[model samples]
Target: MKKNGGIRFLRWLILFAKRFLKDDMPASSAQLTYYLTLALFPFLVFLINLLSYTKLSTWSLTEDLLTVLPAGTMQIITSVIRETIEAKSTTLLSFSALFALFSTSRAMNALNRALNKAYRVQGTRPIWKNAMLSFLFTMGLIVLIVATLSLMVFGQLIGEHLFTLLGASVYFLHIWNLMRYFLPVAIMVLIFSLFYRFMPNTEVRFSNVWRGAVFSTIGWIVASLLFSYYVNRFGSYTRVYGSLGGIIVFLVWLYLSSFILLVGGEINAVLLYGDSKIK
Candidate 1:
């Protein structure tokens, strides 16, 4: 029974993949990539600036980013972050915040459209309503990122203290180290699940969303690791694009990331609607 169930699931997944492609994921992804690129630097600057006033340093923020981003991409991001911190001018803060809000909302809007398409639902929200929802989502994402960074920075300290109080052994420390990596990925999955649940026009059950979230998170991690490995080993965008290679690479990465996100939403749609045509 289990084996047959697995086969049936695979068949459904294959059909979902076909439907996703038919829905024009690539075009939507490209649009998302553009908005993401517009938002990326401003959002990072705003975030780093906000963190600078706190206990966290730019290096800590960069390290958190390094966990998921490729080496070259990380370098580019870190350089910009460092520059933003060193400039120390409040003049850009207002501008950065506004730009980040607008661009991020635009990106979220694109995702909202993609999700609606996947769910076979027509968009019924007014412009103001949609913009407000996007704004809220954008803020939620920023908060999620800040919380994740805080955990990465302080989780170890808290763990060590708890472990020492309990008289735990070295094995626990090893496990904690692994959790440091796994926790961020788990948080990402939860965030993706939230996006799946709330972003679409149609309602989704939490149970069904989790299936897609897990699938999407695993797919994202595998794709990111493989892309990073390929880039580190054989990729040479710098030789081809000179100083602009990093930007090019970043854009391509955003596109792939957007594609993965849509695929996840498609999975949820398939499960929810069961091969129904778009409404």
Candidate 2:
């Protein structure tokens, strides 16, 4: 019993460290999706701006309706963009034109693997189909952002109303303290629904998706906060590197985001695997 216990402890520790560093597993198909996500984020943002009622700047509908990240975050992002554009916007734009075709292939394969969670192994898709599905995924991404922003607005309104009724000061104390927790929970719920509804491969139980969603979400929030802290502290990489530093920041954020997502997938698979065996 003690021997088994030791092994379990070691395993848990290893997993925690991986959560901290978000190291990539080379063979993972999802890793390609990570790149695809990075390569595609800007394009998707462009599409969302054209189609949706939002711009990437202030009063962004996407943040209010879909992505609901905190205020002032966009300003940091804009600073990054401006710096990048000043340096090599044209080169990056040309590179994006070339990468759009190949990098998305990695993403399509990764999404297929995820759909596999819903059912049994299936045949591969044609290139056109992957593009179509990827496009659909892109649409879903916009809706998701809009929903988040909307919820954030609604939540803030409610929190404000409650504070007024309950002697604003004390209520304000609690609301301010819990913003991080509530905002992330809202996002987790949104992601859980997105996966449950859209994934095309198999029929995953709503429960499994949410469990994975929550796991992924918590990991994402903590990791991001830590990254911000590290960036502020030892690295101060953003300030020293100036606009160039944003690339480093972006790479770290993207890689870590991918790792958190995969960890959630791993946890979901473990739970599903156990359930299958028991049945």
- TM-scores for all candidates: the values are 0.88, 0.57
- Spell out the clash pairs found in candidate 1: none
Clash totals in order: 0, 18
Question: Whose lDDT is greatest here?
Answer: 1
- Across 203-258, the per-residue lDDT of candidate 1 in tens digits comes to 77789899888988898778888887877779898889988877777777778888
- Where is model 2 poorest over a 10-residue stretch in terms of lDDT? 64-73
Candidate lDDT (C-alpha), each: 0.82, 0.54
lDDT computed for candidate 1: 0.82
* Cα lDDT for residue 131, candidate 2: 68
lDDT of residue 78 for candidate 1: 79
Q: In model 2, state the lDDT of residue 90.
A: 51
lDDT of 2: 0.54
For candidate 1, the 10 contiguous residues with the lowest summed lDDT are 60-69
